[model samples]
Target: MWNPHAYLAFADERGRPYFDLLSRVGADAPRRVADLGCGPGNLTATLAQRWPQARIEALDSSPEMVLAARDRGIDANVGDVGDWVPKPDTDVVISNATLHWVPDHPRLLIRWAEQLPARSWIAMQVPGNFDAPSHRTVGELARRDRWAERLRDFRFRESPVKGPLEYADLLADAGCAVDAWETTYVHVLTGEDPVLNWIAGTALRPVRSRLTRAEWEEFRTELIPLLDTAYPRRKDGMTFFPFRRIFVVAQVN
Candidate 1:
């Protein structure tokens, strides 16, 4: 179970990229919009502000997230994107900092594209930091140490962000107008192990979910040396973590 409280730690760092992705949406007067994997609905609420004329639906698979969203008076529901059936009326579908959790995301993209009406937009952003020092170090620890056997069933860390041309081609093949790009965000963090702290908020959820408290602690402990080596502490006690993410915006024809 992923804890929303734990994930909220890096809200500032993650929120910037989300806003950048949303800016790409550029919805002038979208009628109906849906936010996929809208955890806690903090970012989803912005869609309502951006397109005040649109009725927004916030969908997330986690009960906790759905409940939080509902408490905020947003039209929130618990539903898996894998099983979600987008309405034909959905004019804009915005998914930020999500999608990576779903396996077979390319298929989902095609399906969402097909579900929307002509000129309907789909804007999404996903972290592509699997190759970053933080992720690579943690992955090495998860696969190389004594706990490796226990974590064998866990999926290895994969880039949440797909290649630009790959995404463009997928949308084009699905008969949609596609614009896709990749960017590396230089996130400056204070204190020690900020990169590790950031991943613990986002990418670490999957690995942590499968392990016991003791095992999780052990894994983090073992991974520390690797993190420090990869992200050497600076004289100012801060670190600059370069995180890459994929952003895509498509309009169905």
Candidate 2:
């Protein structure tokens, strides 16, 4: 039950990394482009604009998100990234802010590298801020006695995302020319409980899905103050949140 509107709440901030990753792709006139985890198709529309001749296809596991993408005139389908296989003509594959959710994405990258056509491009970005205060606070609360048993199987703190070097090495070993980097963007956000509102779109989805409506509300009530404390509003009514992300762009052999 993904909420497309909630996910797009901070679209500007969330879309920056995707643009940064795309700039490094260096794909010219790709015949086919695929956007894995293309939420709401807003950013995926940019891909079409960049290469109008290329066929743009997108996939997301959430039906709601896929519906939203289709409503935006994107060729989107409900599918999981882990099971997706690139077609022979696919020249560009972009997975932005999505791989963190796939635990075995390293293997998938290597497989894609092997399967893609020669000179094809694969670009991806994942959040590297799982250890930051926003996530740490959630993990601490989920581990408490009151919530521990229910959240025992959920992963709140640990991130499946690898470091930049790790991804570079893996892709390089798979016969790709890899460019990997990390960026920490300090976003100045305004409004009450802005941090909470931000996570509600992403990091908090699993927690919310696992808890009852009343339980989710209670958890949110407890989380609001902690997030506020961690990301306090300054005199100008702004909250400075430093988010870290890892980017990798590989040209497959």
Candidate 3:
């Protein structure tokens, strides 16, 4: 139900933060790599370009996204991240802005740490803005308003996330050499209802899926007023929506 095309519009906005998260790979040369949740494969293609000698495979659960990625000539496939495991002797596993979707990710991280080769890297970034107002507004409106009668269970989708320390500790416990940090990214999104537009492509999918088209429109309409107030329009007619994201890089030691 997540409109992958609409999400692509904000991909450029998310690029810088995700790239910064990946810098931990440093100058280490990797022979092969995999990109989890490689939406449209734009960034996945960069992995191929950076390590032209490396075998790069991009995977996502969305068939639409997989097709888009394949059309770009990247090796793309549809797969569930929760069920994905590292290939033996794989050199690098790079996941940008995708880890938050999988529930109980600390355990997943520990599992991946155990599977990846010694000296190889596991790098990931996850949106950490679940407690922010942009998200809070959605959850509040979903439960407090008239729509609450029917969509009572439509709550904030739980993400498997922890503070930077939590991730570092998990990796350290697993005998990984770990690096972790958080970043606040102010994504400058164009047009009205920028925050709504951003979530429409991602988090709002579950809510959208539960409602009729008219009900969805009504929900969107009701939600926009709240977001506009929460995230005021800039002088340039764009909205600068701040997003906090967690980054972790662990190398099997």
Candidate 4:
């Protein structure tokens, strides 16, 4: 039920962290590259451009995203990223802003690090914004009134991506050389209720898909004002959305 258009509305802003994650990958030349959770494949296509000499492919669990990616001429498949296995000669595995959605990602990262061939590279980026005001209010609001019953179980959506040091240690234990860090992107968003528009593409989807049309609109009415206050507009009417993300690049050796 992922709306590609909604996800891509903040394409430029959403893309910056991916690019930052990509830039940190140490492999100068790779023979095979895979982008896990390569939503819409727009960024994955860039991987082909960056390493035209390499074989590149993208994987997303959403059929809609996979179809859109294939339509754009990128080799994309609809498959769970968590279930992916690296090809024997796979040189690099780079995932951008996607690992957070995979349940128990830290355990998955450890297993991938242990299994991938020595000297191969694994680079990943995941949003670390669970406690941020934008997301906190969702859980807060879900606990009240009519929302409490229909949306009672909705709060488990908080991403399980761990802190930078934890990933660093896991990769190190798996005999890889790891570089892990955190970055907080303060995105200045414009247009009407841009923050709503932003999360609607992502974090809002769980509630959106489950709620009836009337319930969704009623929820939006209550949520909008909270978002407005949580993320105040500047004089120029731009909302600053501070998002934190964790990045890990491990070269198994």
Candidate 5:
């Protein structure tokens, strides 16, 4: 139940890392490009613009997201990234801000690297802010006595994403030339409870999906103050959110 509109709330801020990752791809004219977990396809459309002659295909696990992507005239389908296999001629594989959601994504990366044609490119970006105050607050709140039992099985506290070096090493070991780096973007956001709104589109989805409507409302109510305190609005009425993300671009040998 991914809210495409909510996910696109800070499209400009969310898009920067993808463009940065793409800039390092160095693929001038790929024959085919696959955007795994391609969200609403707005960014996937850019791949088409960059290589108009190439076939741009996208896949997202969320049907809601795929529908929104299809609205943009993208060849977007509903499929899980873990189940996706690159075509033999697949020239570029882009997994922007999506790998962290897939368990054991390191293996997936290695498999893609092994399966792609020689000299093919794989570009991926994942959030690296699991230890940040925003996520810390969410973990803290989820552990409180009032909600602890209900969310006992919730694993949002544990980060599945690895560091840049780890990805670089893994891909390098898989016979790919890897370029990996990290960036912390300070995004100045406005509007009410912007951080909550931001995570509602992503990190909060699991909680929301598991809880009833009333319980979800109650949970959000409890979370609002915590997020507000963690990311207090400045005198200028803007909240500054520092988001860290890791990027890896590998050229398969």
Candidate 6:
């Protein structure tokens, strides 16, 4: 359901969380690296640059994404991150902005932490924005009037992304040195309906994929104005979108 072009439209902003997650990963000179949910492979290419000699690999669920990434000289395969199991030689594993879609991903992390070899690391980041108005409005509107029944089968907005403490304890209990924290980035966006444009690339994807062209446009009509009120344009005509994300980096102890 991911359109590579649409997802990459706000590439810089979407890439921020990936870079932030990578910045905290302390693994060095890894023998092998695996990037889970490596969408479009733009950020995964950086890992290749950082460790040219390492056996670097990437996986994503979307064939289109894998194809796009391969075009960028990144070796990516279409595979669900949920079914991924690190090889014994994998020294560094990373998943950014993609785990929330997998049910019980925290448990998945714990299992990986328990099984990884010494000196190995697992780092992940997921958007912690279910409670934000951008998301609330979308869920709210979907449950009203003629849309509720239509959208009944498309519900998945409230993801199971956990808090900093939950992740901290999860990895620590699994015997890894953990660093977990949250960051709310207030991105100043320009252009018309900037907030809508931002989520259109991400949070709005499920709804967009399920709705017809006419239905999507109608939904957009309701969504954009609500987003305008939720994230009012500043005097300089830029919309400030506050995005919160949670990051955890775990190195096997």
Candidate 6: 10-residue stretch with minimal lDDT: 153-162
lDDT of 3 by residue, 16-92 (tens): 77678777885356877989989888788888677888888788988998888898898899999889988885788
lDDT of 1 at 139: 75
Per-prediction count of colliding residue pairs?
0, 0, 0, 0, 0, 0
lDDT per residue (tens digit) for residues 1-253 in model 6: 7788988888888888888888887777898899999889888899978888899879999998999999998889999888898888999999998889898898899889877889798989998889899888899888888688778865556657889999999889899999999999988889998888888877888888878999999999988888889899989888888999999999998
Q: Cα deviation in Å at residue 89, candidate 4?
A: 1.2
Which regions of candidate 1 deviate over 4 angstroms?
A: 157-161
lDDT score, candidate 5, position 219: 94
Using all chains and alpha carbons, the TM-scores for the candidates as numbered come to 0.94, 0.99, 0.94, 0.96, 0.98, 0.96
- Residues 1-253, candidate 1, lDDT per residue (tens digit)? 5557766777777778788877777668988899998988777878777889888988998898888778778889888888887886789988887788888888999998877888889998887777777777777777886867877765656665578788999999999888889889887778766767777866777788888899888888877778778877789887877888888998899
The better-scoring model by lDDT among 1 and 2 is 2
Q: What lDDT does candidate 1 reach at residue 191?
A: 74
Error of 5 at 156 (Å): 1.2
Candidate 2: segments with Cα more than 4 A from true spot: none
Pairs that collide, model 2: none
Give the per-residue lDDT of model 2 (tens digit) for 1-253: 8899998989999999999999988888999999999999999999988899999989999999999999999989999899999999999999999988887999999999999999999999999999999999999999999899989877866778899999999999999999999999999899889999999999999999899999999999999999999999999999999999999999998
The lDDT, on a scale of 0 to 1, for candidate 6 is 0.87
As a whole number from 0 to 100, the lDDT of residue 224 in candidate 3 is 96
Q: Pick the candidate with the highest lDDT.
A: 2
Indicate the residue-level lDDT of 205 in model 4. 85
Residue ranges of candidate 3 with Cα displaced over 4 Å: 157-159
* lDDT minimum window of 10 residues, candidate 5: 146-155
Candidate 1 has a TM-score of 0.94
Q: How accurate locally is residue 88 in candidate 6, as Cα lDDT from 0 to 100?
A: 84
Residue pairs of candidate 6 with colliding backbone atoms? none
User: Tens digits of per-residue lDDT for model 4 on 1-253?
Assistant: 8878889888898899888887878787788898998888778889878888999968999999988889889889989988988888788998888887788777887888777777889999888898899898888888888798888778545657789999899889988998899999999999888888999888888888889999999999999999999999999888899999999999999
TM-score of 6: 0.96
